[model samples]
Target: MPAKRTALIALLAGALYLVVGVTATDSLLPAGARGGDTTTTARTDTGLVRGTRTATHTVYQGIPYAGPPKGAHRWAAPRPVRPWAGVRDATRPGPLCPQVASAYADVASLEEDCLVLNVTTGASAAARGHAPVLVWIHGDGAVGGGAYFDARRLADRGLVVVTVNYRLGVFGGFSYPGLEGSGTFALQDQQAALRWVRRNAAAFGGDPGNVTVAGSSFGAAAISGHLTSPGARGLFHRAVLASGEGMMDMPAGAMGEGVPAYPHYTWRTGQESRDTGVEMTSSLGCAGPDPRRALRCLRALPVKKVLEVPDIMNAFQAFAYGNEVLPELPEAALGQGRFLRVPLMSGATLDEHRLFVGMAHDAIGSPFTAGQYARALVTAFGRDAETVGARYPVTAFPSPALAWSTVVTDRMWARGTYAQATAFGRRTPTYAYEFADRDAPMYLPLPGAFDFGAYHAGDTPYVFEDPDAQKYFTDAQVRLSDTITDYWAQFARTGTPNRPGLVRWPRFEPGGAVPHTQSLGPDRIGPVDYAGEHRLDFWRRLAGQGTSPAPRPTEGKEQMS
Candidate 1:
């Protein structure tokens, strides 16, 4: 974030505080509520609640869906939150799940008491009645993110919008010996939140049976995982996955370690996850010959002591098998038609890897040399290095840096996205998209040398009404936002993104060799050959021949939603 923009937001927030007679921090506050006068109270399964009334919707925040995962409950499946006695104040969003500090911390504070959810519905009761429900899960490498997204627009569009905060980092995903298949605490938290929605949607003026689980990046992978998790079955009827897919992962030893690490965001077995946790235990000097005793010693350490150690961030913390919750890898299960037959929407950005490589450029100066680009490719793609280079020659691109970003975009992001989308299409009604807005805003400025066009997470502001970023959108972009949100809300309501007045978005044909993926940008919504656009043929050839895939180095947002 730029200093000038930060100061401007601070000044505007201060002005809002004066106008509303309440201090406004970075949290998502209703646009125009003052002195608690909005009569935003409602009842829940657990207790009564009060929210803040805005022009468009009633906003409820800090609603717990599960018990706090702390101390003795650290690695356990989420227990139902105990009911509260009286009406609870819910005007402000809950704190974020504990995480290693990152950009998300700038907006929402961090706390262990973070297994909470937020709801947004029409300000008027009639407007909310029978509205479709949309539950959002956020993704940022599963390290940070929460429910700070402002969903008043979607709520006003006849939808009940629920955003969630789950466990993150090692706290939410760590597994050790004797705790087999228990590393997926974050996923468990999501299921509990979904169950809460199913039980409480009617109270929020939403249709309980018409629910959609939507997310991006890790959040996308998460909902996709839920499609295969027995515990999450029958909870949601529809799904949306953006900037993520069912088959995203890295080959072993691609990131310099014999053990797959950091960029590998896929399912592992219980023993594989336990092995990684043991590495953390050894790093903290809590290792013992008896693995179970070492696990106990690691658990005994203070949460602060554990979180403060920055090295734990690199450990793979995705869901593991060997338990009933997630019986197998979502991709493998999804491949074999083992997932729930829900209507699904999945996509990635046109330039998904720019966000990552732009950050990497911080260390490597602009205009990378051929050797540097090849070395980076070898690091990400391992054995497929030569084939990948032959396909995406550095001389063919404008620069070596451009060529590298293209490989990361194609091989790491687009490849998995294609595999996952077509896989889901094979089993259910599906919609695929490629966010192709080349001039999307750069939240974090890259040096002049990097062009991170339509990068990963770029479509988030379009999904949620962003007060800060929206201020800068051109008329064309605002119209694009309207189109995107309308499509999403329509999908939640009717298991499809198409409506009467909008351009037709054809559903993915289950067995099409290469289905048409809708291209979204300023005043444009048309189908494109997603397979060819991302060069999936090259990827399929590489994968079919048992060649290595690629990965990215870095991975943020305040609202992991």
Candidate 2:
């Protein structure tokens, strides 16, 4: 079968399992529980789960870490999975959580019974003391993603890898008048998964106390949440935040506030999220004078009905803060030194926002004209638009579109990523990086005219066995992939990214005038003047509404090889 067909079949099978798991009564207490060898039939606290061992490792898929957050359990903290009676098959991955369809992923066929996880351990991991547990939280914009990374390679390097799925959209974030913990259901689900890992890491030969939480993009955003969440304390001892950080702030407001422009990493208060839920209640045909009745009615609606409601469905892409789970904005928490000080490896692709700009160009079927570029800055940054345009002039780049890409990359991602990394470094052992392969693979289509150098999510292939890597990587890129995995595994094992013979990734020292960041690319790993290269000072000044300072021309030279 074709790859797409096979993947679709797997997804359909997940939906089928979803039906079987949630048909009549409490779904967490699935009837079957497997009891066999510890490797193949590890006994979790809840029940026996029969996992499949591959030629190189033990693979366990679709293990329930939490009870189904459906029916009476919807919008509540995940209940512990009830013990089962017979052996349960742990071969196939669980259903993908509900999410909005995008140009990248179409998860319309999935369901709400998606709180599941997958684990991969080295072949001898069960022998004891060899494998360190790496719990992965897949990236999503609070909306779409599932636990499907092929971590066999990472596992081969003496690690036990765990991937997880959490609720998305309204099912994950809706908060209203009577809902006690409504705004943070997805976060609660994450904590539940961590709790499960803490309880069962030993069965798979994973060290419970050495757990490392890692994620990319939105997953990094989530790790940031966990870093700040008091409820998540002690669940994991180390973190790897890729592409996004916990304290990333966008101008706070509505999702569509920027329209054709993108919003910064802003979040909502519980009341704001509740108000959103109120509007959603009416949108879903559940509106009434009684708040309790409306919520009850909303919960009673079929999953498909919720999916069919466009706004409620799309709302999965955002999460709300200021609740018990989040309490305050993560950035604020981190700034105030109110976050867990763990070993952190956080970084982003050099041209992070270029992918989005490429998509925008693809949307209009043309490059951004100078006028359009100016208009966007004005729209996104308002009175400061001229300062932004003056700093990132169209004449300096190949086209106005590329200039716009550079502007946003530095403005929203680079500067804030640096600031947050610096903030964390003051309190924790922090390592920072930037994937600077200017000719990095184009995971998505862009006009041949546009080069999305080190585009958003560019580092993903280096970390996970994404099919795109197999499909697009050159021989040199594959070598880089190996190097990248080594860095990731080393970090998970020791809370430091350095190994015997690679570029020494320096710790981010914020008290200094210059911030040192590593650059990862094909056959290249070294330090770069990251702040100067991205003109971060200019962005900081612009954001501060102060006189903009021109950065010396990008220190284009690598400090080390």
Candidate 3:
């Protein structure tokens, strides 16, 4: 490959890693501490499990919600775990699902029996009666597990929080021509966990009927899938989607060279998934005239051998449509208002694509030049390159990289966010927000000169407790964290993120004279003209005038996982 091509591929790979990746902490407990108060116990559907009790919260870790998806169950839908006889120790988290480490993400694992969940509740949860349940799904379709997030802070806010681990990468999403659960095993795993919550939440002093599903990035996209999935209906009464790609469509050359645009960035038709799986089978030495035989051979392979296949995990990151779990594309379902009528809170960070762009250029010590920026616009927007360039001139930004980041951020992230918010607002009670804390702390261990201005997943540390995050936060940021946590807790409790003391968050009204998307910054937290700020009108006009290329129905290879 040419130098430029290699750089482009590296750039795309880094961007994909940042989009799906999240920092994983080793332990949420104090260093060297074996366990907390051992008397804290909850009876799960399987059996009684002992948990740890801290000053603020009671945590039950590594509680199996479903049977291990190993061996013959590798690509099959999740099943219930066999009931245990005695009190099980829920002191440590389970191993992560199968995945490989990358430049941006440092976590890796080959464990297939990772279908477990962690529950956190206030120390006085039993005394507080049944608190609302918040089931959290971690981001990164191929990497990162539920244990990465510490839900103690959220749990302390008078709610029962549950973080779950399902399958990841090929284990989660691999599809064969005649696979029974083609392209939906991960989703099935999530649904199974939710069902577990419904059955056993009362044991943890949680109100199962008032469950809220929440996540960021890929996890948010999964929540979007749940919103449309018939299997997920009534499992969650509320939803929170942060930096989700529910309505996102990829642009040409946006991810890498020769990468075509996709109409649905996070979805694949069953046929497309099966095609990718067939290609994988051929590469894995499991190809045969019969699809069933090929699938059996693939499933029989060792976990390490299966994971050794390059790009296998990322290839199956997308959820497959035309199946029972997700009968149609989530984007189409949202556009047609054919989804669950649950209250929703959806938003994105101010600089959603900066982390991707920064990791691509600045982190790698290759500063993006003005020439490269111009070429990127042409590559991404095609005939509308001139118009896009004119709108986002290099002179307006601090650096060429930032300028390019803004272009994609506005065109891709903001436009999709606005569309999703509008779609949700039209039919359901919707609350839209923008995490605009430009100086938010950078929690990821990324070495770069780039300014990550409230980049993608920046708000995660605020909602979940990260021990190292406090050292980077100022007093104002700490207050901002509290406010965000309060808002989320309120949303989880009552279907709305409003309270008497906090800044009033207005419900999103589509087509209103002035939109009410709350801009969440350290200094100011109130409604802002989100559409105007992101120049959604320009994008709508660009699409209306047919300057932007129409997204292809499906792509042979996915650009981002």
Question: Per-residue CA lDDT of candidate 2, range 1-561, in tens?
Answer: 011111222222222222111221222212112344333778888888888765567777788989888876888889988789888888666777776454344345347778889887877898866468898877653344444466777888889888888887678777778887867887888899999999999988889988899887767887777777879888988888887745555431111123333232535666667777776566677888898888788778888787665455444444567777877777777765667877888898888777656655643376668888777777767887787778888899988878877876776788778867876776777899888777766544233556768877767757666554456788888888888899989998998989898678888877656767888988578888888998976776655643222222222111100
Which candidate order results from sorting by lDDT in descending order?
Answer: 3, 1, 2
How many clashes in each structure? 1, 9, 0
Better of 1 and 3 by TM-score: 3
Which residue pairs collide in model 3, if any? none
Tell me the alpha-carbon RMSD of every candidate.
8.0, 8.5, 5.6
- Which lDDT values do the candidates have, in the order given? 0.71, 0.70, 0.81
- Roughly what TM-score does model 2 have, to 2 decimal places? 0.86
The deviation in Å at residue 436 for candidate 3 is 0.5
lDDT of 3 by residue, 1-561 (tens): 011123344334434443333344555342113444555777877999988776667788888898888778889989879998989988777788888877666667888899999888887886776899999998767777787777877887899999989888778888888899898898999999999999999998999889999998888999999888889867988899999998998787665556667778888888888887877656688898888788788889999898777677777767888989998988999876778888899999999888877876787688889989898889898899999999999999999989988888899999999889887877778899999998977655567577989888888887887766667888999999999999999999998999899999999877578779999999999989998998988998999933222222221111111
Model 1, 243-323: lDDT tens digits are: 774587654322222333333356767777777777665668787778667667776777777765544543544666667
